[model samples]
Target: MSSAVLHRDTRFVPKKAIGGQGCYINLEDGTKFLDSTGGAAVSCLGHGNEKVNRMIKDQLDQLAYCHSAFFGTQVSEDLASFLTESTGGKLSKLFVVSSGSEAIEAALKLARQYFLELPTPQDQRTRFIARLPSYHGTTLGALGAGGHVLRRQPFEPLLAKNTSHVSPCYAYRGKKDRESDADYVARLATELDAEFQRVGPESVCAFIAEPVVGAALGCVPAVPGYFPAMKAVCERYGALFILDEIMSGMGRCGTLHAWEQEGVVPDIQTIGKGLGGGYAPVSGILINDSIVQAMDKGSGVFRHGQTYQGHPISCAAALAVQKTIKEDSLLENVRTMGAYLESQLRQTFENHPYVGDIRGKGLFWGVRITWAVWAETFTDLYMQLEFVKDRTTKEPFDPQDRLSFLIQEKGLQPEFAVSLYGSPGTVDGIRGDHVVLAPPYIVSKEEIDTIVNVMTRVLAEVFAELGV
Candidate 1:
């Protein structure tokens, strides 16, 4: 039947998820599937978490909506304080928004405004340098700031021209065979410096990047010293360092913030997904004290405003999520379970011909599929299937195959009954496929075993179906 709501895929109607508990979701037909990806790693504590639900309800009962421009609510105030305190006062100001994309928009504007608010207004500093294959958000400003080729394709004509892209510090693809980690980082730093020089360093406002790349490039983390090197480049050019930790922060990377593990602090940080843990649509920007002081000394106000900037209910939900993470000691579980998950994945796919690389941090892992050459030339059924290879190298598969979709489809079958996050265009904007797995922090050893076992079956079935 025709529906009123427009779905992601208009051709197919999805099954209704009527119930969920812990790490499992039950459909209307009573089929339960393990939520291995936590709905794109948003449900950190998992579904039907009583603590978060209770807080949301309580906030609704007490005070649901209050425009930030008019009045301040305790819920929003407390949430902001909690977040700032969590950062040890490094990030002293919080700008609450409803989604990750909005947070990014705020960060971009704030960074630019910060320059303007300086004692000597840097009105010319209007550019941002982000890395390629990164996913920041889909909104116009955020999209302009992002470097995802496919995402930026149709909107190329309209996206802001001030933003340019540099190579991401992806070791798997960027590092040379003989290059040491330090040398690779140095090389990447040099490239970034060159980009700044080409774009005119004095005209740049910030260098935005994800601590651990999410959907756009799968869950790829930078090699050691990568962040410091990049940060050094930004500092050298007097540009703010903006970290898009929307997917990697909020304890998803075994720490409250993914940057903590890298020993670099971003001047402006955006966090979402697990911040509210699927309890509410909430995201925020954390601003450094220095930026805030600059603005305070100047116009004494940020030049941006949103009607629902500090939605009380969203803040309450996120507060509860953070409190739970702290009280239950979930980050410990994230580390323990993250190690177990990585080990299990390595053991299962280490010898699998189709599996090329498995890399991630904490609970977020990405399994990159083998390139087209391996799949077509080495696999048994190369001639039977319609293979689409990269025109230049004939290596990676063409994006037209929808390989990631097939893996996700097979994983959701009744036999496997699992949910895995699938992302494509891993090699440039039109090639490569990878599946990302981000289980909830509360996942158990047995649950990890189930996820890996089912994924193994899913991969085998998908490959067989594809005649590979």
Candidate 2:
């Protein structure tokens, strides 16, 4: 009856996801799964959005495909204007791309170009600094900037060597127990300063990060004063600040933009996932006036683009999605529902011995399983880390040893999926294992409760089986 290629654990065929509505994905087999992660936090407006679909249809009716160079479309500019307006108009330019990875690649290259835009001989700087356990994207350039050891393994040689990482603002595992948030933040900032010094500050072009550590740390929001400290350090080194909001922005968090909560703005910001609300594949980078002015003064051309750059229909869909969010005030909904989700998860999993942590902002949240469960399942992950020595040379069954894979499989069950929003958990600071949750902007209290209930059951089931 069906002959189409499929992926991801062929042992269990996923029911064909033919459609979606609000927080639920509909299958051709008449099954529905709650979209807790909003398809990797992309579907902010949820699915089957009549307004976005209408806009796409309207744009397609007028023009389907137009090369973005010679002819700039009204829809793209309008979408850009909306984004700039939403972001407080600090950003002057928006370069639309097709996906988050491409957006990140563009942002990285843009930072390099911006430095070259400097007229002085100091413009040759091409170095970038990021944090460990932070993921930028999947493409070579983005992955190069990303510090995830597991994702960077096979192509490690191909990645740009100019990019290096400092310690993430992660406090749970890395922060000393005795350290206050302020002191811990200062320590991280000091490390960053040292890195800048090590790299010879002038040679570094940008300091990049996911405002909230996503995917790599189970939605680990930085400790207090972290962003402000990092921002100050970046400015001290005269490096551009590039914040990746692809996963945490677009109202996945309670704030319309996660950076709004972070209390610092970036010279360049990349966003996706929620922008088009899964109605279309669209992601873009927002440029502050400084970067734009630098380009104007120097290399006037970004020299980077895609065939689908600022696709008219994609822009139209995103614009409509944005409009709907604004008109309906979905971000307010996110804040309200996010609080409810947090309370539900905390109530359900906080005391559970196996569920180690529950942390996030807005609707984007995560649950981490204890390291005790790691040794039993997903043990192969240990060998994947390049830095770790297989001390089968008399290694103990350390909980840390089993943490990564244990956290991953712990979330998967017959009912729901977490970490679908757009985060991976951290293990020994590298391998992915934590589960993230990113429900839609339109999620209800009932739906949030259901998600928590299902998640609790999954954690219980996994832990009980492990005898934890």
Candidate 3:
């Protein structure tokens, strides 16, 4: 058989997903796989949700699409109101887009436009500061503002030159032993301040970061007081503080917003994935009242436009998704199940020889694989186990092994039948491997048990096959 569609990996064809229901997906060959990662943590509400389906159908009957330039749809307006109100009026405006990448593009443009719309028009502000090993999106603007190493490598020349990178607040491999969290935070803050000073603080436009880093760092959250301190540094330079919650927000981290747990509000926040629970292609940016006021008082319009910016069907679906989350009180379940999942993971793998770190919040979790061994010299044992030769050093596996991808492939076998989001380059941008598990909010205890059990077997098999 042949395929016409150009897949992400041109060399291989993927299995056909014929249908999805609840927490599982059915392939054309009759194999059912547990969708533990929810297709990159997008399907928060699970699949085959009748309530959301009905809403989309109803919206199609009423209206499907509308250009934002001429008229606005009620569904779009309602979705915006729902989002803004959810923030308790902290973010007074919303700019709808079709994907996380689009949302990031919009946020970047809005932040730049905001400075231009200010009373004095700080046109000198041009640069953006973002953390390394971060994933924002694939678009050039978003890629420029992000620090994902491999993603930016091919298109380095095309990316915007106004952005710079800084070290992430990664406590696992970053925080020194015996270093207090406060001291680590202070050091990060100092580093940020130095970057600003080096880049000329007056020329900086914003400092963008993920509330909880997504694929690049594999669900790494900043230590307590990290966000506040970083935000304070941004304030010192009068630059906007932008949070990319594309993978960690919208109840994915046990709260409606990941920042709710961090005790800081970003000047601009981009959200996606779970925003519409994968029912529709939708993402958006929430803007602070100050930025909205500046734009409203000046240009009176954002200098950006997309043909499908506020598609009615997308908004209707998103509205239903948000309504269901609130009406069903699913956030409570997220907290409960998240805790259960955490306990289960720790109990199962806390002492595993190959598992290096297990970190996450809410439903999003990452298990990093590192084979640490105490040996006098490199020998057969070292050749057999490739991951971090020494755990104390927190070293990473060779990128050539593709260990995470191997685990992902093993998990998809009928014997395992589980889908885990596996990624590499966790340590720097090209040297580590980890697998993320983000089941739908509707996942039950039994389902979680199955996920863990399957992962346990899959990992054991992988290690045994490697003769580690």
In model 1, which runs have C-alpha deviations exceeding 4 angstroms? 371-394
Stretches off by above 4 angstroms in model 3 are: 372-389
Model 3, residue pairs in steric clash: none
The worst-scoring run of ten residues by lDDT in candidate 2 lies at 376-385
lDDT per residue for candidate 1 within 1-468, as digits (tens), equals: 677778998987788899999999998878898998989889899999998899999999999898888899998889999999999989998899999999999999999999999888999999999988788999989999888888889998998898999989876567787999899999989999999999999999999999888888777788889999999999998999999999989998888988998999999999999999988899999999999999999999888889888899899999999999999999999888888887777777655666666778888887777642221111000001112233223255557668888988888778888987887878786677888888899999999899988887887777777776
lDDT measured at residue 115 in model 2 versus the true structure, 0 to 100: 73
TM-score of each: 0.95, 0.89, 0.96
Task: Write candidate 3's Cα lDDT for 183-286 as tens digits.
Answer: 99999999999999999999999999998788887778788899999999999999999999988999888888889889999999999999999999999999
Question: Which should have the higher TM-score, number 1 or number 2?
Answer: 1
**Per-model C-alpha lDDT, please?**
0.84, 0.73, 0.85
For model 1 the local lDDT of residue 161 reads 93
Q: For candidate 1, which ten residues in a row score worst on lDDT?
A: 376-385
Give the per-residue Cα lDDT of candidate 1 at 328.
Answer: 99
Candidate 2: misplaced stretches above 4 Å?
1-6, 9-13, 371-425, 429-432
